[model samples]
Target: MTRTSSAPLRSPVAALLAVLLAASGVLLGAGGAQAAGYRYWSFWEGDGKSWAYATQGPSLVRPDDGTVQGFRFAVSEDSADADRPRHAPDFGAICADTPAKGGAKRVALVIDPGTTEDAPAGEKPPALRTACAQVAPDASSAEALASVAKPLRYDSSAMICAISGYPKSGCGEQVSGDGSKKDGSGKPTDDASASASASSAPAADDGDSGGGPSAGLLLGIGAVLLLGVAAVFQARRRR
Candidate 1:
């Protein structure tokens, strides 16, 4: 008889850990800030058997040595739909390639930045690609992980529009989450005008900086944590 393997589910502690880590800057929850409506992402991680949703975000997650993290972009509406399946595209399919040029333990970030409605001036329409991936060679440390992961969400640069022809209609100014506009010197110029300026920012033509944790890592961490906790519980019970 063949044994069927079900996908692993995230344990509570693992999930909590991921949220805590992500909150510290490993992942960005700024999906609600996109111009094309808030583009939230669904997180997934894979084990050899099956993939599962993370219990928490990337900033809070510390995956076992070689975990794969996967992300798929969704509009705010679709993202809010709790009934949707937690898995998507597949971690194996996303991270199928061998390491580019390293023997170090690594963590991968597979991001789907999502489609844009704007067509660049004097250029052909952009080809539709699935997603982009970033690999951190030495992912053993939290600092290194943050360095590789934070860019996916936060654009430190003041300029929002990278393309030459794309008119700068939104987010030309530096607006914080509170809608307070910051001057060039980085001070809030207007305390009273707190608008949803962050959401109006145009999509960067450069690369994936959408902030979030990989589902794979979170799931893996959760699994490991769960196992560890279960072992402890069993030992205590026996004692």
Candidate 2:
């Protein structure tokens, strides 16, 4: 009788391989989710005395009433693109921030006019972008406008980044709102909008001073399709 060659049993090995692959796929998907949702960029510039910057804000939240509140914008000293008919100035960076809770932990921030850096997922801020902003927190306030009725330094060296909304519930007992915008009287201050954290940033200066944010030209971060897809991807990968 002729001897016939037999194939080795492959069940155990195939199962092992499948398990490994599934685990890897899960890990990859999680990483991608986190990467997709966040304000991942920042930029700014200075011409000795004056400077400008930009940034993106947290992902847009679709509440029951259909009101959208989020910001991603650029700040500039000169009206760039001015020569291009109805247009805006060239921005430096688009800074985006989110609250510790109430929303997605990640917010993708993107700006137009020009781009110097487009970072990959899970990117740590580079030294250049980090140095782009100076902590002139004082400059952000109206105190700078004290001596001059119409702040002179503000036009050149101030930043305005305050944003809040209407029909809000107890939005500002601490920063800007005088509890007028809230819906009811008994609501606790703890129930304020989660993203209202930055509400104080601009409200403190403009709201209390009764003069509005001095920057007048503060930047914004809008919800564009480009940002929407990117942010969704980030959420999936992180999972």
Best by TM-score: 1
| lDDT of predicted model 1 | 0.37
Q: After aligning candidate 1 to the native by TM-score, how far in Å is the CA of 3 from where it should be?
A: 81
- Give the alpha carbon lDDT tens digit for every residue of 1-239 in model 2: 87443223244434545655565555444433321111111122222233333121122221121111222221111122011111122123211232223322211111221122222223222221110112122222122112111211111112212111111122122211221122333211221222222111111121212222222212111223334445545544544
Quality of model 2 by C-alpha lDDT: 0.23
lDDT of 1 by residue, 82-143 (tens): 11223343445544674444544455444433344222223232232223233444342222
| Per-model TM values vs. the true structure | 0.32, 0.24
How does residue 189 of candidate 1 score in lDDT?
21
